[model samples]
Target: VTAISGSNVSLQISNLSTNYEQLTWLYSAHQKILEWEFNKTNLFKSKFKNRVSLSGNQALSIFNVQKEDSSTYILRVLKESGKEEEWHISLEVFDPVPQPNIEIQKKQEVNNICHLQLSCKIPDQSITYTWYGNSRALAAGPQSFMLEITVNSENHSTSYTCEVSNPVSSKNDTVYFTLPCQLGKKYSWGWEGGHRVDEVKKDVGIL
Candidate 1:
């Protein structure tokens, strides 16, 4: 059996002996009769039913089918001597399930640098990753699990989330960071600054 077109499938059988004089094809769905072709044209078609064709040369083609329509196809050939040979074909369709996983790490901490290293752990099946803050995407990224926040002041007290998705499913994770920045005091020079400047100048002149 071979697929002749996107919507069509072809089954071929060969016979070297003159034993078979006639061929008949029959099909069923969930054990219910759906189509039967006997000594007719090579093709069978119906708008309300699936498209199946039988050629004069003992080839069968089924088209426009769905997963639920899959079943076993039985072909019988009758010989001129009143003997018959039978063959069977089974059809199966499959689709993959989408993978799900978390996008970012569950917790994070910010340092005095006001920077943070955020991470996400996505399921191995995920294909892409998206990070968001306040419902906006974090920008360009490739994978779903691994990410770096680059640690910035804006990350403080912000509710960040990572959303991971693929063709079939999606998953997400959120974390908040409150960065601790310790401010230092700046020294100011007054009359002390003027006295220090004069003292330094006098010492330099004396030397």
Candidate 2:
């Protein structure tokens, strides 16, 4: 079972028969969590006092799950015919994925083509990143957080999206780029008799 942190999770008991005499929930090896006998339920672990409960069908429900709650749980059932059955369940909890932030690492224009390098920022390394262009998936790999693209007059105003996801949650962010390759110009301004004057100094170069 996979669950997100600060969420609720339920571990259901499958193939349960209605003729069971007793039911017991154990944590790890021998740490008892709860026991059901003679139509009465008793909770054994103080740590799960107000955070754990059993449903009508003997399914275990945990509230406000945390990272420390990831472990193996066992359920033992005793039938009226003196037969015992055991089931082992493994639970894994993960933090929610945060919204991805895209940053431009480098941008330059050469021969009317804009070359750009973008990076996706996130603190967690155990997640996957996917890049999209104009709502279509890019050619980058699932683990690639860096993207390099070239923009020209045909695709100057293109939008890119970065999606970050884990086993339990996902988030995405988008960025748009407008590239206009033209000659760079410089301007000079001066004040003469309380009047502002402006003039173009010179053309720097193609940018």
Candidate 3:
């Protein structure tokens, strides 16, 4: 029950020994499959060195194997009523690595200073940076920076971060800002009209 079809690996032997007399396979740990089974048994010492033959063309096809070619297969069927049957196969290999993308930026309006922004978009390459606040470690700028907030009268609320890594993959982003207020209405500075002493003496007040 060995299955992997991309690098090639398929072993299905349901008792195949109907007058067959040779079969071998191994890859339990790789050594180049014992140097490809000693160059296909050239040293001639038939304990099936490098394990041999999966078929001689009677419905068994083994071709261009890879994925370490897996291991554990032995079949030496010598039947003429002298009976012999041995079969076993086990191989599993897979490759996968791709799933990373994180971006964040939300902390707008902080007069007197206060800003935090970060970004991370990975699909191909070019990523390696780290910055975290509230989680500590914040001192590595390049992707973005302009934080200088200083208008907190004290109430506690300050955090900023931006961490993105690369060796394979990593992502992070955070933004925070505090200190900017206008609640209802506190704006009064005008000069739309001057004093009027009886409407400013009928208009003598235009100086």
Winning model by lDDT: 2
TM-score leader: 2
Per-residue CA lDDT of candidate 1, range 1-207, in tens?
322113445655665254566666656422322223344444233331446655555567567545454557767767779887777777553222122222233234345344334555543442466767556777435553554545456544355565654433344555443332321121111111112211111111100
Quote each prediction's TM-score: 0.38, 0.76, 0.22
Error of 2 at 91 (Å): 2.7
RMSD of each: 22.6, 13.3, 24.0
- Expressed as tens digits, the lDDT of each residue in 6-78 for candidate 3 is 3333455664644544333333322212111222422224233333333333222344444455455443334
Candidate 2 minimal-lDDT segment of 10 residues: 186-195
TM-score of 1: 0.38
lDDT of 2: 0.74
In candidate 2 the C-alpha lDDT for residue 107 amounts to 76
How many collisions per candidate? 8, 0, 3
Instruction: List lDDT for all candidates, in order.
Output: 0.46, 0.74, 0.36
The deviation in Å at residue 106 for candidate 3 is 6.5
Query: On lDDT, who's better, 1 or 3?
Result: 1
In the range 116-179, model 2's lDDT, one tens digit per residue, is: 7778867787777887877788744456899887879787546677777777766666665444
Residue 120 displacement in candidate 1 (angstroms): 14
**Which ranges in model 2 have alpha carbons more than 4 Å from their true place?**
139-142, 155-157, 180-207
10 residues in a row with least lDDT, candidate 1:
198-207
Arranged by lDDT, best first: 2, 1, 3
